[model samples]
Target: MTLRRGACLLMGFALLGGCNLSLPLQGRAPQEVSHRTSSFEPLAEAPQSEILSNLIQRRSVIAEDSALGDVARVALSSGARPSEAKLRTAKLRAEAENKNWLPTIGPVVSLTSLGDVLASLVVDQVLFDHGRKKAEREFAWADVEVAAVTLSQDMNDRVFTALSLYVTALRGQEKAQVGDRAMRQMRAFNRIVAGRVTGGVSNLGDLRMVEDKTQSILSMRDTAKDEATAALAELEAMTGTRFDGQPVAALAGLHDDGGAPLEVLKADAEAKRSVAQATIQRASLLPGLNASGTVSNSGSSATLEASGETGIGLGTGGKLKAIEASKETARRQVAEAQEDAARKQSRLEQRIASQQRQQAEAQRLAQQGQETYRLFQAQFRAGQRSVLEVVNVYEQSVRRALEGVDAKYDVILAQLELARDMGLLADGDAI
Candidate 1:
């Protein structure tokens, strides 16, 4: 009977030793994609839209910026954001690590089928950890707040990126328009040169001169087309919105009246979410109670054990002052960030104002040049000017016109950037 009991005990331990008890470490959820939706670029069949109205029709650039930013925010929360899944997983790991603080309990029972069988339940509740366990929980929560701040910053960066691409798309359209106008002027000059060559008034070399200019304009056209395509593709990739036409960025200023400043959003979450949570770590420095008990019965025999632990010894209560200091640092950092953002925003606004002033000057020059071209056209028909002279004025006018277009869009780009910085670039607020 003694040998049988010893064999059973050894076999039970061996079997228990072989039992798999570790956590099921899942392979990191296959590389998280930042794009909220599967990218499918369909065959583009819509007519090319060149007016700013295109932005107004489907969605404003600012609106799209805000929407995509929100989408990315959701992705961050769901472990789908770029590099965010790991951070989110870390928070989960922190919480899982905290489970170690809970007491480990075990059962002490006789392996028998008879009445009055011996049994005991032993529990070790490691409580009153002088704020250690509480601090750990708060720290885990703080990690989540850190993740939120990271996501908000990431979303802020993406908003600027998307808005910049929209501006690029707008500028590309301007280039395409200028290229188109230049090509038309080149064609007219080539026709005049061909007439002179046929009439023996000009040589083949003169005709080739106009043709060379035509070729240069053609190259510019091709370059513009390529750039437009690239900008559209990049926009589509980032925001999942097809850019088939010119992006019209209507002036959308940031009217952030009620929303919290971006700096506050950038702070630790507990501090942002609750005032009491700011002192959470300090509260953790106090000892917490850990209560444990054991009870056993075998026929007429009975036993009981009850005990508890209070935090003591070694570096306890020393870091509470440091934790309090960090809370103050967080607040100061928030204020500094807000001020920096404000300064940057002011710089963009000043630049936009400057661009607007330059746009007006360039438009005036373009108008005067256009009038000169018109008068030169009449003079050529009336034999007061040559085709070559007329073409020179026409080229100069076109250059001025292109300059005006560029200047106008530069202001628009600056305005969009300012709105992005303010974190309120929405579709509905018109310039």
Candidate 2:
């Protein structure tokens, strides 16, 4: 063909194919993607308000002017997590895949019969692909959803870690305070025993026992101090912030209300992804139709093409059926994930309730022990009870007090655990 004739033919082909060419092509999903249906009620792409609102509200309450808030904000701002990077990558892939429906322009080089190279520019658009392109787009979007959930999971986990460390440090400090008070009381007992022994009113053995108790309390105080220092250092390292006197915020209203857990969302995303992949695999076993327009130095051509696997066998039918079955499997997996999350949340709630009860009981016993210790001290002063008996009562009171502290922190840790599992420790937008 003449150069001018080829140019006109190419222009005609271009105009014909331009009908499907849409601008602002990136980041647009195909409207009729199959995986997007009512079956997936809590769609992976759905707004996270329901899922994260309770936690977000809780954060609003406690995250300001609190240690937990500082730790979370600092940790989140420290750097991009691996999951965040993955989400970014998935977003890019989805954007690229969103434009998959658009025409592709590329150079084609071939050897002619005269042993000469021919160069042409080809523009190809999918006229029909058994919905393969749609499946691809769905897959890419699903991947993005999964990555988003992962990012949420990772961020929540990070915040949970920092908060847990803070809680640990707090627990250690409280224990150390308890130990210090106990040590002071024990030292007073030791002084009394020493004075009695020197006056021959008490034996040396009594003074030795009192000294041992004092040393034990001192050891406990030192251990607790060490723990607090270690936990504080680690928390500082993770959040890149120095934690001075951050108060522990009450986690009373941080429980999950009713929403999809991160695990369920991740499963839903994976299910849609699996179904989309199955569709693509099934399409691959079949054929795809494409329209192509080529402009070359020597000629111009327009053609419709159908392409598929280079080889086909009887097993192709079985493969296609297996691919179809995988869709059901993916759906079942999502249901399983939901069940698992429900069971886990129930267990965590039960644990929190149990810890709260234990804490209350411990505080009650601790108060009663304090009254008993006061009564014993009065008896000892009146010469009705021995120093040993008074000392034992004091020890019991201290033990009960320590138990109350432990139980209180246990509840906090359990609540934090529940929040982490629910993906509610960090705000969804923050993730």
Candidate 3:
């Protein structure tokens, strides 16, 4: 009967205690992602300003129905993306931390001096924690933001890789086509040299040299075909979709001028996380007040307690100052990250511009070489140029054509890299 009365009394106190606390015991539930982004004052303006808008507008670069988009969809859906899973976990943890200020209930057991068992139900509520709970909540929120940035980076990387491989396969195919045309022209030259030798106008050595040159062109074409086949196989394995014909559309000019790059966002999130953690640690060094109610079989009791280190030594001040310094360090890291991102963006922009120029120059040179080869062919027929000189001019023209093909693909590859860095390869919602 006494134990039953004590249990009832404990239940009554638990309810009363829950009602008396100053802090919010029942915290708010998890909100939408936009709310999460806007709630943090430091990073609040960054997302809403223009980066997110630009991300939405950039979706046209890789439309949902395009081949690049198909590969992205397949790779993202292949399995649970690790960064996205981490983001989910961080949100769950934040949800759990939200209610950390609430009172806790647990069973407590002990032995009496006479070796008897003493058990009770204890309810513990932190009455004063020096803002430890608040700092912990902030830490959890920052973690979610960090995870969010990481997820975006991962998705962009995956899409960039898939798209770059597709471009590579196409590049190899185009080069092989150029090689095939060169081989056909070389075979024609070989036929002429053979007829000249049979008519006693050209020696056997000339015929052999033309035949060898024809063989070399065939080998180059075969090598290029082998490269295309390998790249296509790899792309198929990665995306689980085999491509029959890849598009050669330009991927440049897709990057917008305004946007916070992923690196800056990641750095800011991590800085907030670091500072919050340091606050939590500093709070741990100070005393905390807790209120508790206990109910035993015999009776019920209530107590208020202060828990922490009993003494502060000489080094304690230095430790506290060091923690403050660590916070400053975190802030400085964010600044450094912003600068680095700006430099890299500038460098990529410059590289893209330079490659575009190189592509144009290569195209011009290739055309000029073709015209030169035609004049050399005319001279050979007029007996002004040797068979070897005509053949050499043809090879030079083919070489220029191959260089032009490389420059074209190189520009596309660099553009894709820039897009990946800017987090423009995938949509924000998709991440």
Candidate 4:
């Protein structure tokens, strides 16, 4: 009898030692990525607006999207920001969930109906559960992945927004300067028309027309100035810095786009989400085995209760139908993500091409404007055209030049966006 008891003890020990154990959330997660510094160098003849843009990018804390991602992580860890704190809590909850899969162990004391007291070392383990625990763990891991990628996407969006704002603001400043030049030309025309009226060479109606034109140009100048002001204010709010009106150079020399095609990226993103959910659903459909062992001693008697419960249930159509449905939903979402990614890739490429065409068109217009100014000059030398006509053509030329500048920037912006979509913003100037 003693040998039999010793054998039972040895078998229980072996079972306990042989059970497979898994912990899902035992290590630290990866941190946010950092962006490279800007490589903008202002030339002596650079526009003031462009120079301010460079300054803002170099000095502002919110300039780099990755830097903001880091701030978000730090805030989440510190529980300082409300949104970040919630993410932190969710991450902690995911890590804590892994603890549920571990075996339960403790000391037990029981009193029987016959007034006998017993003491035992108790252990309960899930010997086999059809990979339910693993599936759940993988699901939890998916949540972490979703959160991480969500943060990255958000930061990328922020970078694009900042870039758009800065470019628009700089463009507004340049266009406002063009308006100023138009106003000056109108002022000179007004003077010349006044002199002609005094000399009886021009009628009051013609003088009135020129004065009205001057007034319109002045209004346009004011409107342009207001637009520039508003754009600068928006940029200031975004970067938390003052943006004084300074000349800035046109955007040029974009970095190389180094990233996978949009199709691959989208598929990868969807897979991460779907696989986790599928794991959870599949795990829930399998049978589970729960086992427990107790070795109790009371006075001259020893008792052993070795028991287990195994459960098998219908899964896809019965016990786990809800889980299966959820898995299907995840699949659908992956399909949608793929479609959206393809659409985005096509649209971005078209925009890059369109911007190039616009740049070419603007150059042609600038040339046409110069030709018009030259023709007016020739007409003036023949005493057939007024100086105002030549000056108006010159204004148009400057306007086209401004448009060309903006068009070039648009091309650069499109390229940057293409890089962003390819996940290559990590290498170049992102914001």
Which of the two, 1 or 3, has more TM-score?
3
Q: Report the lDDT tens digits of candidate 3 across residue range 219-241.
A: 88888888888888987888787
The lowest-lDDT stretch of 10 consecutive residues in candidate 3 is: 38-47
Off by over 4 Å in 3: 1-60, 113-117, 309-311
Model 4: ten consecutive residues of lowest lDDT: 38-47
Candidate 2 per-residue lDDT, tens place, 94-172, comes to: 7777667667788989999999999988877777667887889788878877877777777778888888888888988
In order of TM-score, best first, we have 2, 3, 4, 1
lDDT per residue as tens, model 4, 38-139 = 222222221232221322232222223343333222322232223333435545655665554665667778898989877776656666666666666555
Which whole-number lDDT from 0 to 100 does residue 42 have in model 2?
30
The whole-model C-alpha lDDT of candidate 4 against the native structure comes to: 0.56
- What residue pairs clash in candidate 4, if any at all? 47-247, 47-248, 48-246, 48-247, 48-248, 49-246, 49-247, 49-248, 50-248
Please report the TM-score between candidate 2 and the true structure.
0.87
lDDT of 4 at 46: 18
lDDT of each prediction vs. the true structure?
0.57, 0.77, 0.77, 0.56
Q: What is the total number of backbone clashes in candidate 1?
A: 11
Model 3 accuracy (lDDT, Cα): 0.77
